[model samples]
Target: MAGVDEPECALPLDSRDVRCCCLLRSFSHFIVKNPTMNCSVQTPQIVGKDAKQHTLSPTCTGASVLGIKFSDGVIIAADMLVSYGSLARYLDVERISMVNDNTVMACSGDIADYQLLKRRVEEQTHTDSLLSDGFTLSPRALHSWITRVLYNRRSRMNPLWNTYIVGGLESDGKPFLGYCDLLGVSFSDDCLATGFGMYLALPLLRQRLEDQAGGDPRKLSKENAVQAITDGMRQLYYRDCRAFKTYQMAVVTSSGVEVRSPLQLETNWEIADYVAGYE
Candidate 1:
């Protein structure tokens, strides 16, 4: 750099090449001489107001969503908190939303992306209504459509950056629960959870399901399903950093869909005193 003039490296200015790397001998000489020196270095631009970039740092993200299928309906739950980095930015945010009369969905991750999906899905359902062919978008149909959308985005390397859980009763009155992530991976089970809930809440749901009629969701009653969801949500509040005490739950039954909000649990922190590092 002391002898050469003008830039020679490419746009990235690779440091791996000998011509680009700074010589240790030159640095040592400069250190010994203690002379003020000037050199030109190519620094790539990293920060800018780019419209195409949305939440590159993953701000305003939700935590987890849990769902289960009962004997007569399907139920899903999510906390009311949307976090901006480590700070709890929005506390009253509702992550569970109605897709149609028979379908309800819960989401975790970028709330902006979730809102975009919400509008797109609404437009899709509205277009379906315009058909007037006596056909409606069922839970499975909506889930399949969402799966394809996510998969297409993933293939383009511009994923939605969210996890979705769809729950509802199909036209035949049979309950359904499905899970899909930004990677387009999708599957349905008796119980479903996303994000931290998958690790902390899913085991409880699965155990509850297994205890009933050998993990058969159809054998589960409304009360049992609600109890399981409540228990899992409570655990998430205690364990998950992004989870909140206040949450919402949606139940899609043959009669109709009912969503309950601002639910809390009575927690006992006395057990913390027994731990080794308690102050």
Candidate 2:
């Protein structure tokens, strides 16, 4: 009766009271059935939280970077194209850079992030120069430093979203090649590749290296190393969708790091002309 607002009934007091009690019970049941009408009760809210401070994904990414260590030095190669999804967004982008006279770095992933990483390396190099008494960072030392930096960023959940290959000669003029990724995972190898190069180019490199040096990358000659890396790049251009014919190559030796001219690979599409779906 308290919620119904019914007109007064002209009846005995006991009967009227009974009817009022019944009405009140009905009103209580209705409120329970439709809880939304009860403004006093609050509904619980749902929220999602994540530990990661930043989202990690590559945008406008470059493809594989290939590296090989040889008797004299190290050789690295990467294509010049940066792709945004399937679209080749940036052409002539240099993915290979000389960190110092003794080291070269090649990277695959977001070009913007790679540029930022390059700036950081340059800053570190400058700082080292200021502090050094005629002592510079060697290839091994630089690679170790970069590995620590990448690992720290990964631990913070803010990664560079790139895979890097550091190749050069150690202080003792020994060939050095190391690989690092966004997660700070790193290892040294006679041959290394990132992205599709790992799938398409790695086998070729391994086979060639084996033929030339019995799988001993350190035993490979400079000419054979260059040939292997160049052939791998050509194969990548032919097979990888994100790759292109134009690329940059770098060789690091006891003398210095040399980045050769941007070169183009010769591609043959003659097979496509005879395919079943030929136009």
- After superposition of all CA atoms, the RMSD between model 2 and the true structure is 7.5
Ten contiguous residues minimizing lDDT sum, candidate 2: 1-10
Report the lDDT tens digits of candidate 2 across residue range 35-134.
Answer: 8884486667565466335745667899999999888888999989999889998898889988889888989998888888899889988998898777
For lDDT, the strongest prediction is 1
Where does model 1 exceed 4 Å of error? 1-56
> Tens-digit lDDT track for model 1 on 29-120?
78678756555587877875673664345678999999999889999999999998999889999999898889988899999999999999
Return the top candidate by TM-score. 2
- Note the Cα lDDT for every prediction shown: 0.87, 0.86
lDDT of 2 at 271: 80
> What are the runs in model 2 whose C-alpha is more than 4 Å off?
1-53, 274-279
